[model samples]
Target: MIGMSLLVRLALLLPPNVPQIPVLCYHQIRDWRPKDRTADKAYIMPPATFRLHMKMLADSGYHAILPDELYAHLTKGTPLPSKPVMLTFDDTDGDQYSIARPEMAKYGFKGVYFIVFNNINKNKYYMSRAQIRQLSDEGHVIACHTLTHPNIRKLKGSDWAAELDVPARKLELLTGKPVRYFAYPFGIWDQQILPELSRYGYLAAFQLDEPRDSAKPLLTVRRVIDDGRWDTSTLDRYLKHGFGHK
Candidate 1:
């Protein structure tokens, strides 16, 4: 441990460069799920594995910045030091409120949680209002996941306005803090429809695409992750070296 500390201490003396933020995207926290059968996909990570990943980041000398902070750095062209990262969760599942939040708190990092407002009480699979508030009070961003998880590209005019704004307003009513960010339902916010995002007062939006190597596009920022099928070595490689794998 002393040698590892000495190594990090030495590395910190290096020069500044672009912050390669591997914004890790996650959902549904339960017992471990094996990598899916169809392809090399990055999706649902179990709560325990998520803990290991956070510990790994901390040990490797990475800082877990929030989505808004990352946006500010990228937009302002401010480079993060070596191994900068932002951890994020979407859908605002109840399990995230129950399991993931505590584990992440243990690691001293808070994630940006995008939620579907309509399911706060109507559905068992999603988070309830009280649970959502507790998470916000704990310091995580409970941003919007739209009212009903629609494709923003397909909708226009009032539909677009409603999809984007109402949930944010709902979150505001619930938590008393203004909602400042958003995430597309399936990483499907196309370029032609970006103006509506501004109409609803969003400062930044995220997409669960590949790792962002260069500067990010305004509407869609990129991220990478260590999901199922990615063992510890693969996870380390993806975070420290490669772009991303499916």
Candidate 2:
């Protein structure tokens, strides 16, 4: 473990010219309802729109890569597929399993599911433990979101264990694999927490649209949220803008 940590520290010092890979963060994958707030609709993707996004990606030859491939590419200077993109779901919504999974499967794509551990089997709208485990078994990466989706910037002391360590252990048990990646709740993080994340054995952590920490780029890996309102053309533009290619 010490040697691995030393390797990571050495890798962290490398120039950040690693190929630009677009990582899309998604939330609920269901259609909007009458009760849905206007602001909340940004995160609630309708089924048809979601399908179109997948179709576009597939048609455009975008290969969905998982966390391990991404880590290797960034740290060890490994080569990626012709058009590598990462589809990451946050918050463990039930629709991600019921809807997003099959849609991605059609394109022979896999995704990273960042789970809120406390919500499993407890919240009606969230995914159950069985569903999460199945995703992991099916080769999709199961990563940590947090215990309760709290803003990580406010956490202190044992709060870190509750949010990071405990949940990560629970997820590993459920998935029968190590949880080595994390997505910050509400895409918020602090520099002080980067070392804490490393101490907890995370290889990397993701945040939404934030400039990466120059010295610790792995911990602050950036992602862009796939808004519910986007059309196929909008997705194409954003992909090009974010990754410098279509």
Candidate 3:
């Protein structure tokens, strides 16, 4: 395993030519009902639409890669499959297990799920511990989304441990794997927290639609939210334009 110091050094030395893989971040995977607010619908993907997106990726010959593969490609200049993409789910929603999981399976795709520790098993809407473990068992990467999905910029003192350390330890115990990746709550991050993430053994952290920090690109790995509102064509355009794909 690379130490934190070496990790930072390598990240800084990364070549400009390193491929920018498109990572799609998702939240809920159920239909948006009348009660769902218009603003909130962006995070609530319908089951049918999710299936269509998966099919599109499959037909387009896009292979879903996991974080370890992404890490290796970014840090060690390892080659990836042509048209590699990463599907990542955040917030531990139960529908991900019930709906998204099987749909992705149809295309032989796997995802990285970032769990909000406080929300797990809190109710029917959230994923339970057993389900999380099942994801790990079935070859999905399970990562942290903090203890309560707080905006990390406001954290202070022991707030760091309460949100990051405790939850990460619990996730590691649940999945029986090292929790080495994180997705910022609401895609918010700050430079000060980068050292804290490193201290806790995180090799990389993700944020939504933000420019990566040049000095610490690993800490600010960028992701684009898979908006529930987009059709397959629109998604394709975004993928191409957003990641600079031809």
Candidate 4:
């Protein structure tokens, strides 16, 4: 595992001749609380900062693509836009409907949201089922996160089945379109589940960091977490620096 991890890190160092599409992973697009000052603030991407990101992308000619488009590019050798990017929001937070959608629309962009089916419409923090459907109706891709957002690696048998299959079934019923992609809960994954993912008819799956398998693309694809610290200039530097850990 250590050797594989090292190989993946080294592989990411080489510059890609093709356009290296960045799948930006975000959680909350809302204000940070004073109590969360000492806590992990990466999940809370401030609305103004998010606006700056959208503005920067728009100004720089970056266009967001759906997750399925990303899958097609990776698997079928399909061509993508000159400056392809994918904006993926995990956990289907209510602020996504309330804040991020409007902010993205300002740049005429659509993002993919991975929803937790069990939490939908059940709490103030989560987007309701109707709101998720509305996003789908408006062209945002609605994908499955899981039923209860449990770490799949820790689950087995029926527990694993419920985690992987149930939400996907419900999502398909909600969207009317096939649920083509998935994002791992907490960015946790096991390659053993890849076969099951294929069985579920998922084109690809995403994780928070670079994937271990570059030989076979898009099973557990890489994504960069858009924490609150990013601004336009810093982001340019980060991408220019091979998106490697600084």
Candidate 5:
């Protein structure tokens, strides 16, 4: 499946003119991060706030597309709405399975979750296999972020492939489904790494960098890192650019 996909993408590469889609990256979904913990502040958000954001998208007439829609938009020249929002989560944090889903459910929206194999809930913060399986069955696209969430820009050869293949195989074996997406940890990427990325069978890849051209996008695309630091104001900036920046 992966080899064919790489060939297809390479065969399609040409002069640009594709419309951009916005993908929003999020971490933890907490009502409030305890002020005492510096890490918690960056990793958490109030549940009510997330609800508001989803409502904002719906109320503003935005449509959230699934992985396939994104694929179509890029590869088939499919058209999407003016405000197409993609909600994505990094790490298989348990709160997202239990808390975030319910909040997003209010708006009838879903997101793609990137899970790190090594961090599957050894601590109080991570998610368990059951929770991960349940969430995957509930319609969210469970994606890979490598085992242990290593920075791939520094990895070489088969070592890098294992980082990706481990979770992809694990998730697929557990879910009995194909794991098709991958999110690069910390938005770090090396363009040279893309060929291997394709070799691994990922249908699409995401990062923190926006595509240089909207028309002819690489399978690996950039998303806006959404957090409490910037409210709807930051999203508005992406909207203005006529690109799916967030």
Candidate 6:
């Protein structure tokens, strides 16, 4: 731990030539209900608050980059904007399309949406195929969340491949674009699943909090979860000092 601290401090002493894009993970965006008992409420951002976040990012000169642009910067030595960040949404929720999309567009930002195949037609809460295509056509990324939103760490080899590959194929068919990125369901993943992801031609995968292997940046990219707790000042602190854990 001491060595790691020294390295971080040493790195901070130097000018940053490479991009350090903070990937923000979000779930739902909707109006808050006072009496709501949903367990996923913490993942919901009120529409008005959501608008504030987008405005703050735009006003602060943060550039919202796409997954392919991020991948190129990380692996292919591509140049990024002066300030770059990735905004991502998980689950196939209707609110993401109806609420977040327009809000993001207001700031001239694009987002990556991870979808759960099973929820499309079965659950009313999820986005439909037509809606998903609409978002993709509008220049947002449609990536794989999972086929059924299962915990990949608990699945065997075949089941893991099915969960990763099936959704990639399904999304590609729907969007007519390659599905190159993935977000683990519930932010749960393990290094053992990397081979399966690679076999499916995934360029990168995202997990919340500390990455499984810090050296493998693409395979285990880190993200910060936002549940509507951030104001502009808090967001500034995050940008300057990180989440403050070390």
Q: Which regions of candidate 1 fall more than 4 Å away from where they truly are?
A: 1-20, 32-41, 77-82, 210-216, 243-246
- Per-residue lDDT tens digits of candidate 2, residues 89-161? 9988999999999999998999999999888877688899899989999999999999999988789998888
lDDT of 1 at 133: 89
lDDT of 5 by residue, 162-224 (tens): 898877999898777788888888877767667777777776778775454333245557776
RMSD of every prediction = 9.6, 2.1, 2.1, 6.2, 3.0, 7.1
Question: Could you estimate the TM-score for every candidate?
Answer: 0.80, 0.94, 0.94, 0.87, 0.86, 0.86
**What is residue 242's positional error in candidate 6, in angstroms?**
1.6
> After TM-score superposition, what is the CA distance of residue 240 in candidate 4 from its true location, in Å?
3.6
lDDT of each: 0.69, 0.87, 0.88, 0.77, 0.73, 0.77
RMSD of 6: 7.1
The residue-by-residue lDDT of candidate 6 on 1-246, one tens digit each, is 012233322322222233357888888787768775565566888788888888888999999999889876665567989778789999888889889999898888999998888878667777999999999999999999989998787888589767988878888899998887899888887777876766566777888887345444566677887657677778766765663321
User: What would the per-residue lDDT of candidate 1 be over residues 72-127, giving only the tens digit for each residue?
Assistant: 56555556656677778787687877877777777787788888888787778778
TM-score of 1: 0.80
The alpha-carbon deviation from the true structure for residue 122 of candidate 6, after best TM-score superposition, in angstroms, is: 2.9
Candidate 3, residues 73-191: lDDT per residue as tens digits? Answer: 88777888989999999999999999999988888999999999989999999999999999999999999999999888899999988888899899989989988899999999988
lDDT of 4 by residue, 40-78 (tens): 577789899988988988888888898767655654568
- Judge candidate 5 against the unseen true structure and give its global Cα lDDT, from 0 to 1: 0.73
Q: Which candidate number maximizes lDDT?
A: 3
Badly placed stretches (over 4 Å) of model 5 are 5-7, 11-17, 31-43, 210-216, 242-246
Between prediction 1 and prediction 4, the one with superior TM-score is: 4
Better structure of 1 and 3 per TM-score: 3
Worst 10 residues of 1 by lDDT: 1-10
Q: TM-score of the candidate numbered 2?
A: 0.94
